[model samples]
Target: MKKDKHIDPYKHVAFIYPDIMDFVDYKWWAKYIYSITVNHLKKSPSVLELGAGNCKMAAYLSEDYKDYIASDISLSMLSGSVCKINKVCCDMTALPFNKKFDLIFSAFDSINYLTSKAKLQTLFQQVYSNLTDEGIFAFDAALINNSYKLQKVAETSGNFNGIKYYRKSKFYPVSRIHKNIFRIYFSDKVITEIHTQKIFEFETYFEVAEKCNLYVADCLKAFTYRKAKATSDRVQFIMKRKT
Candidate 1:
């Protein structure tokens, strides 16, 4: 079916995203990250968060750190932020920042959107350049197990006020890609947004970080301190500069 209007990813979703993700406990998530910062760095540090969609988590996280900046590729998403901290619209692979941050991170499997090993490497390079000597880069990626779980859902739909939205989700094992197609119905037209994420092997991230002069400080299971395994559904990687 041809869509009446094709909006950028997160353009229309931004309006209802909070409602869609109302189940998440941003407070708990913020606490988890904050604890990691305390354990790893031993002090509150300057922070830069990449792919901070709507900065909802930032609303709960920013106060604990010395300095914080939330960034995303979509301006529309940043415009919907729940917090008042610094927000910047920029690509994760090519960060534009003059000052280095003590802790640069991304959450919610945002790194999976890179879709290519080359892009992942570029992101690591950017992180390497933007990190303070003792800074760390922390992020998560959805594993194949996550893709399998997503495929089980297949489709979901919801309505906000009078606006209707439907999502079709699929995962291709052979291609290692997870795609979500969203159709939002408005009074005048329908808007469609396609989002694709690559499920890379658990080892690939370590390889990329090594090549970028970054070393893995830890790789943990989501929401826990246990080391992540190949069979894990989602994994968080904490990396530090080699120097």
Candidate 2:
């Protein structure tokens, strides 16, 4: 099957805005992940992060986990990162590792970039196959309800590393997807990029996990420790390998 072309635009943005890409802040998220895993699972084990863009999360986990590996399809993004990461360039749907990890993670709604059920199924299967017995697979996805509610917002601006960025976002109710267009006005030049992501139904995740021999250990609202509500913009899932 032909891969989705939607990611190409963002890949361009990633190349241009590599310095400003720290907006996602994977360091804080990694701390939270470590706390949750240690509190619940009670062990500091090997971790593999799929779609580990910029390696911020992997850097944060370097001291916490026994081993850390960061994988992403884009080598440029990984090369420009500040973190000391053992980076691997590979597709998430076909992880190249035969050894299982104690925990696997992909954050910032990276899974939503797949844009199709079949792709997501393949990703889940790979994650399941790469996890040790009873290991955890944690990830986040955009929520359809929140995407629809915030569809018509106008452009917003932010400044990073002396570069001014104008960002505009639109949501498609029919497809439950959100598209973000960014215009970066730098001292040297102006660049534009578009990013597309799907807002998946909460139930759809459970079904996908079932097909991959995984089960949800917990689901929570993104950026918070609270339980996920219907109106939440992002839903974080902690899945356990069933077999």
Candidate 3:
């Protein structure tokens, strides 16, 4: 099958396998993201989440905020979510809103799918423009070692609600890209989805943030308070629009 480069990969999966979210273990991650976000902002601040997949994390963090908007490119993906909040189907690179927010964030390595540095900088600028003077834009990055320095094949196969799925992940060092292939065979239908994410260099992030006039306040190893290094598997970067 010819993959559509223009389409969001999750769109098809969401339509065909909406029940897949129930099988995944995403609670711990949602809690961790909330922990990092809560400490930086006050209670009941307007928030925007980019690449909010299935609204799992938003569901976890929404109770503490006054306003929350979750946006994803795929409408089907957003619909699969149980969250009953403000949801929008939109691209991450071009946020189509004038209302500013106190905190803007993205979770689950969604930014890595941005294949180039230019797109990343544009996203940073958009987030900066959409935030208040002292607002925060928090996101995480998968570092070089996360994709390039690993030689492993990790997979999870399971059945849920009569749907059987096999998800396989493999990293290609030459291109510094990781591919997640989800093959679902159920109800006499065979659907395969290929999702890809790139491992960006540490300095690339700082350079893009600098170009966008956004100052990074924290770059920590994910799920921990340790400083993020070039080799950190996953690094969370918290930034704000320059005052």
Candidate 4:
């Protein structure tokens, strides 16, 4: 038996991300995010998307603003953009931009990737530093409910462009961690990527945001304006930079 080669998250799997996430409605999601942006800013605003893997959402979301940049930690992932968009490869907690953005958002529950509260606070501080005076920082977080429900799916496998891939998902309730292990077979080697997400409590987000000098404008149920409860599967938070 051959040993599987370990790779960084999204390094090799970025190539088949679209195929794996085919169920996502990027267009509709872009529209939903756009509505939130307009509701807060009341106009098209300069935009920055953090953890914009593959930039699929950027393809449609970028259309709403004249100045838009898609950023992710993995260069391989940013290279998978569906169309031409200003792409920056950088860490969300340590952004490397001089200019501020009016609207900074991350979709697909990307904020859950921060494994610790300190990192989450750092990310919010970074957002506070990079946001315009009236800027909004919007992001969705996958809660415990999402992880519990997804754990039932357990395993899935498929092939994309002749490359075979398999995924197994697990949730650790005690640790509040949701982990996904992926095995992708290339012609020569099998690459393994382990993706982990923290399942933060519903109220912890507000505490972190407040500590980072960011004001929580709203915390809504995912895809809607309804208030989110502790049992919500996912929630979207709208934060504003402290003036």
Per-residue lDDT of candidate 2, residues 13-52 (tens digit) = 5655555564666678788877667654536677888888
Q: Residue 216 of model 4: what lDDT?
A: 85
Ranking by TM-score: 4, 1, 3, 2
lDDT tens digits, residue span 96-167, model 1: 899999999999999999999999999999999999998888988899998888888889898887889998
**lDDT against true structure, model 1:** 0.88
Candidate 2 — which residues are off by over 4 angstroms? Answer: 1-10, 15-25, 40-44, 148-153, 158-164, 184-191
Candidate 2, poorest ten consecutive residues by summed lDDT: 6-15
Return the candidate ranking by lDDT, descending. Answer: 4, 1, 3, 2
lDDT of 3 by residue, 1-243 (tens): 986565666855675454645655566776776777777776678999999878877886787674999999877788888889999988899899989999999976889988788888889889988988877888888877666444454777777667788888888777777888899876878888898887777888999999999988988998788998887988998987787
Q: List clashing residue pairs in candidate 1.
A: none
State the C-alpha lDDT per candidate. Answer: 0.88, 0.78, 0.82, 0.89
TM-score of each: 0.94, 0.84, 0.88, 0.95
How far residue 223's Cα lies from its native spot in candidate 3, in Å, is 0.7
Better model by lDDT, 1 or 2? 1
Candidate 4 TM-score versus the reference: 0.95
Could you tally the backbone clashes for each prediction? 0, 0, 0, 0
In candidate 4, the residue pairs with backbone N, CA or C atoms under 3 Å apart (3 or more residues apart, or in different chains) clash, namely none
Scored by Cα lDDT, where does model 3 land? Answer: 0.82
RMSD of 3: 3.7
Q: How many pairs in model 2 have backbone atoms within 3 A of each other, for residues 3 or more apart or on separate chains, i.e. clashes?
A: 0
